[model samples]
Target: MTDGKVKARLKWACRRGMLELDVLFIPFVNEAYDDLSEQDKLTFERLLTCQDPELFAWFMGHEACEDTELNAMVQFILGRVKV
Candidate 1:
């Protein structure tokens, strides 16, 4: 897929019922997605596949993601935003 198409899809995927998530994800995709290594981009996509509640907990530091890779990705995202 083209970069534009991939970004479009990622933007759509970033939309969540929770405003907090939307704020984090939408901007990350817009500003940072293109800069990601291909593997990290894939990891981001994998992060998206997680359930919202799980994502919320992880992002909010209520719980840690059990999968080390996913947890690292979560920390990466949070670090980007300094959250």
Candidate 2:
């Protein structure tokens, strides 16, 4: 797929059933995804595969991922929304 198609797909994946996840993901994909390294892009894609409850736990500070790549991606998303 072309880069544009990949981005379109990622954008679709960003639209979670949960409003809170939507708020965090959609803007990040639009604004920050282009700036991510190839590996970080993969990491974010991996993160998108995780369950909503696990994502909520990590993003909300209830828990941290043992996988460093996943943790970093979680932090990357969280960093964008912190005041």
Q: What CA RMSD would you report for each candidate?
A: 1.1, 0.9
Clashing pairs in 2: none
- Expressed as tens digits, the lDDT of each residue in 1-83 for candidate 1 is 99889999999999998998999999999888889999899999999988899999999999999999899889988999985
Instruction: Please estimate how well model 2 matches the true structure, expressed as its whole-model Cα lDDT.
Output: 0.91
- Tens digits of per-residue lDDT for model 2 on 1-83? 99999999999999988888999999999999999999999999999999999988888899999999999888878877885
List the candidate 2 regions with Cα displacement exceeding 4 Å. Answer: none
Backbone clash count, each prediction separately: 0, 0
Worst 10 residues of 2 by lDDT: 74-83
